[model samples]
Target: MNKQKIAVLGPGSWGTALSQVLNDNGHEVRIWGNVPEQIDEINQFHTNKRYFKDIVLDPAIKAYKELSEALDGVDAVLLVVPTKVMRLVAKQVAETLDHKVVVMHASKGLEPESHKRLSTVLEEEIPAALRSEVVVVSGPSHAEETIIRDLTLISAASKDMETAQYVQTLFSNHYFRLYTNNDVIGVETAGALKNIIAVGAGALHGLGYGDNAKAAIIARGLTEITRLGVEMGANPLTYSGLSGVGDLIVTGTSVHSRNWRAGDQLGRGEKLEDIERNMGMVIEGISTTKVAYELAQELGVYMPITQAIYSVIYQGASIEEAIKHIMSSEFRQENEWS
Candidate 1:
């Protein structure tokens, strides 16, 4: 394997775990955090206090407070910050680095108001030269389990097969595997849309729905995503890949998924405001619900599940009302669109 200096930026759990993976791969790893205290903690105790607590980070990974110091000798960058913080983080990195980097993002979201995917935002904010190097890596992996070296699967999506291949090698380890895909748009859209649907699934599950009901909701949710993605010219096969159903399955069921947890609270009669105050971290689905709802409307696609999620999260609509709306309005045949 070609050894390249890797810099994992972001002080979050996912970023720290990925950096630890690179450190284990025998590559030079430099981690950069926007916070000074996080930098001090990582360098001193080799653990992230706020994020991945108790998990000892790799000794090979060095921490840097300054963004420039992290990017200085790095060959590639793994951008794992949350969706909302992505642009600011990219802008900071762009100031110090000019070369084409193998930029990979683990964030699965679109800017809520702008309705732009993370890759699109990165392409616009980061230089065009770096745009060609930009790649989206997403899949079923959750940071909590990955920290313990659990088996996980992810896809490297980029226009350039060689770039995807390089990223595949860049992240692959014994307990983690990477796959490559050229359907960058589809992979990215699936990654984002699944989070939106996972919230709906969690809400349904928390509402005392049976396995059959949950399965039906998930199937229909996927159909909604496929409709929107297909309208945007994304290959249907891409939506069926790891970045799609694989991610959806994990996010919908895993207790560690912030989106799922938030949805559960909503279903159990907790208000969105209270959930947000408690989470402290970003529950991306709450933000993504708005985008998916608006995009489906703008694209003239039928996304009832996304609409329900949006109404409950943003429109001040009641959870019971959202359920009533979905159950009463639809009596269509299965696979009717096909």
Candidate 2:
């Protein structure tokens, strides 16, 4: 195992929160943010005012405006930027990165138009010649809860076990737990598709659907995610773990969730463009649902919940119509796929 200097590459809620955890763990940390004012606040006040105001940042943490400075001499890096900018940001880090330091990411969701999982994009974007050190940290981690030092658990996955363990230590705190897994594909795939389900579940909640429907959505949503993930060569059990089921439960129902907020608007008959533009946060569910809908088509999988979400958002299907469609569908034994 290597003692590594880590850089968290984004300064959004997730990025800032990850940096705070690492700083608390006594690792030398630096971060690069595109926003000049955000960087200034982090440096001078030792706090992230944009997303996390209640938690005080450790004074020892550092910030760099330049990509070179952020990636310089770091043994590992966490790519915490949005899914859309992942490739562009990864390329910048790959150019200056030292081979000894591994790369870990905390971002989730696939590129909708490209239909690529985040890890696939990372593999393609990062300089292939830099050597294999890519891993992902995901699960039921929310930036708001993490900033308050809540007990959060995440699954760290890699093709390499040592790298995964290294990541486990980088962000793990007394209040935060990290678990290791070698199923990188499983972890990333589940992480992406599960967001789509969360959005659907949120839509159900917003429509005043009862707990019966919520529980059904949660279970059936896992089934859809698992089916797709398994088709992509992921472990079936990964969906049952924290990064899969745990994430779905949190992002599905939490008021702090941007994805759920978007889903609620859709349930309330708000336009997708308006919801997206007005929310201002990265409502990953919007993008993830579209990608998952296409993926289900490509894979010939029956993902009814995902399809219903796609219908409501893109096909101009009404909330009541989607609900009726789901309820009116054909019936089957519960253990058919189990």
TM-score each candidate: 0.96, 0.95
Quality of model 2 by C-alpha lDDT = 0.83
lDDT of 2 by residue, 190-260 (tens): 87887787777778877888789889988988888888888878898988899888888888778888887
Which 10-residue span in candidate 1 carries the lowest summed lDDT? 124-133
Residue-by-residue lDDT tens digits, candidate 1, 1-338: 76789888877878887887777778898988778888898888888878775788776688988788888867888888888888888888777796777788888888767888888788878897754557888988898998899998999988889988988898898988999998877888888888888888788777888788778777888888888888877889987889888888888877898888888888888878899899877888888878888888888898888888888887888877988898999488877653
Task: Give the Cα lDDT of each candidate.
Answer: 0.83, 0.83
Give RMSD to native, each candidate: 1.5, 1.7
**Model 2, residue pairs in steric clash:** 75-101
Off by over 4 Å in 1: none
